[model samples]
Target: MMNRLFGKPKPETNALQTLDKLNETLEMLEKKEKVLLKKAGQEVEKAKEYTRSKNKRAAIQCLKRKRLYEQQVEQLGNFQLRIHDQMIMLEGAKATTETVDALRSGASAMKAMQKATNIDDVDKTMDEINEQTENMKQIQEALSTPIGAAAEFDEDELEAELEELEGAELEEQLLQPTTVLPSVPAGRQQARPIPKRTAEEEELAALQAEMAL
Candidate 1:
């Protein structure tokens, strides 16, 4: 029984360590793939130069090297894909574990809540809430009512005052007199004439002067 419990422990640890190593290997493969891509480009350039120099063998060799590099890159891609699949599986497992834990916690919380409350207490609480609401409503209505005081003017008195104002207006209109203006002529306006100096005026002036002398 103890063997059954512990026999698989080392295997599990080794599996985890293998996955870690695989992750590191995948990263290294990706780096190597990038380097190989650069090398392939360089080989293409080298082939072009060799072709320009009329060296057919050297150009063909460079092309071969570029193809080999591409093959290695393809192999590296396969390795990366495998690593991605493993990571996705692990993530799914983790999410499933968290989901189960959350469900269990919720179930426990609901059980505790069920124990903490009773229907009778809920009904009593509701009754108290309704009573307070009614009391507050009554208080608001009481505060809104007018205190004891007689109105300064009743409705009939107000109507009588309005009629008096209308009568005064009518009387004032009857007392005002209507006026008429005289019509003016449309001729040229004339000013008052100055007195003329005549012989009689001269003689009177001369006689007054002789009397003074």
Candidate 2:
């Protein structure tokens, strides 16, 4: 029983680490593909040179080497494609795992919060918030109030002061001077002076009297 329980072997590599290694291998393959392509071009040039010199066997050999290099390049391309497919699949799986884990954590936290709070507690908290809000509004209103004793003056005192001013103005008007026009007498005509007669005037008057007699 002990042998059966302990007989299983451990994994030689972690999956993520294996994927990283595979990516490196794909990169190496791409580098090899580039090198092979350069070699193929060189071989084609060699084949052309040999054909121009009429060395048919050498030309054929060069052509054969170029074909082999192309085959290896094709194989490397397939390997890179496989590595790309594996990476895409691994990345998708990793994203899905993280998403599920995040959702689970959020749900657990919400459940814990719900377990910690009751309806009565929620109502009490809301009442506290409303009380605080009202207190803040009252404080703001007090702060915004106008400064000085004007806010404290009694309405009756103000009315009394206004009446006193009006009374003082009336007394000043009564103290001013009153003017009266002079009256003239009616119905009194003045007499003019009469002239007195001289002595010559009397003699002439006597002569006339004698002639009449």
Best by TM-score: 2
Error of 1 at 108 (Å): 4.8
TM-score of model 2 (CA atoms): 0.49
Clashing pairs in 1: none
Worst 10 residues of 1 by lDDT: 7-16
lDDT at 151 for candidate 2? Answer: 82
Per-residue CA lDDT of model 1 for 1-213, tens digit only, reads 887876655544555676787789888988999999999999999999999999999999999999999999999899899888887776676567678878999999998887677778888999999999999999999888666664344779889999999999999999999898876577946567988989999999999999999
TM-score of each: 0.41, 0.49
What candidate 1 gets wrong by more than 4 Å, as runs, is 1-23, 108-213
Off by over 4 Å in 2: 1-19, 118-213
